[model samples]
Target: MDMEKEMFDIIHTSEFSIFSLSQLPHDDNSLLLGYEGKVKSFDGRTGKIIDLWEMHEQRVNTIDVHPGNSNLVATCSADGFVRIWDLRCLGKEQPKSIKEVAHNRAVQSAYFSPTGNGLVSTSTEDTIRIWGGPHFENLSIVKHNNKAAGRLSSFSAIWGWNDSYIFIGNIQRAIDVISTENNITTPLKSEYMTNVPCRFATHPYKEGLLACAGGGKLFLWTKM
Candidate 1:
């Protein structure tokens, strides 16, 4: 199917290139979008800007909505910071709270745990940091040396089964699994793997299943 040719609707937006976008978990009518140093929420159906604010010193990297609370959102940035926003105060000019200097280099991505009680962020500095609570207090940090190339090919971390582990790719041809309980990291062994995986995703409904991509190739792993 050609989606562009069979489109149902399209709503033009402001003239800035969006770096990342996330829809509120429970709201089909709203969307959160990030661009250069700023974040905005818009009416998904009408393309109307509901709120706007500058929360980063550089380009915003990614935005993730809390799974349990649709009003809560997390955004990471090229300025090495992560911020928590409350959509209840959507018109405010600043984030409700922030973790200043959350990373030493550009933060590539941030995701809230499926339980919405933990937040994890990855950076170009070869580190992953975890925070606890809906308020996002810093909890632990895991450092690695995956010096893979290219920002477009950068790695992302995601919470895996039971929110007990975080899965990420390293410079080596293997995935690194970090325990959320004790901040320990171990490599995933498999018959097939993606070398220097740049991005990966966990199956939404299937436990221990993952898809990884890098170097023009993709690999799927089952049962961790």
Candidate 2:
């Protein structure tokens, strides 16, 4: 019998600290990293930077790659804006589109829809916004009161497999299943958990299977 071996690999080092990171959806060897008011793409295998830019005026909070188009990246920052970047552009260029004041307070997270035609952003102001197009037209807004700040401010949200719905965590220790078409929120039952669920991820290959975590515990839920 052979045993599995573990190895540690350092991809890149820099003077600045990294706050957020996301890999290109189609490329495992590439990554998008967020640091103090800046974002960059690095080749993980070679430890060489592919592109770099000062993206925001404050520390970037989150980065998400477009599911259908890896070249499109979405980033939110403490400056309260959500900017979409085209990775094909040169390092010195500006974002392809910027959602100015996407949230009234510091933006916590921003993600591209699975279809890559829309974007979703959450903020410390207890609001989640949906946007469409490169110009970032406001499509919808869902409000909830989960006001933790700083490192704890960020709550997870992701589109459903078919893009018909979104799953968001709330302060009340449950997940909110929101309908994209009607903007209705239904709380998922979580009576067994003692703490608020701060993050959620749907099963990649199985429908109705979800994994959520917070307060040092993980919970798995499936459709009944």
Which candidate achieves the best TM-score against the true structure? 2
Residue pairs whose backbone atoms clash in candidate 2: none
TM-score of each: 0.86, 0.88
In the range 39-152, model 2's lDDT, one tens digit per residue, is 888997888987788889899989998787777778889898888767777357655453354567888788877777777788878788887765667578888775754454
Please tell me which predicted candidate would have the highest lDDT against the true structure: 1
Residue 129 error for model 1, in Å? 0.8
Worst 10 residues of 2 by lDDT: 1-10
Model 2 spans > 4 angstroms off: 1-4, 91-101, 133-138, 149-153
What value of lDDT does candidate 2 attain over all alpha carbons? 0.79
| Backbone clashes (count) for model 1 | 0
lDDT string, candidate 1, 38-142, tens digits: 888788677789778877878988999888777777889989888877767655655555344467788889998889888888988988888886466657888
Return the TM-score for candidate 2, rounded to 2 decimals: 0.88
Off by over 4 Å in 1: 1-14, 92-101, 150-152
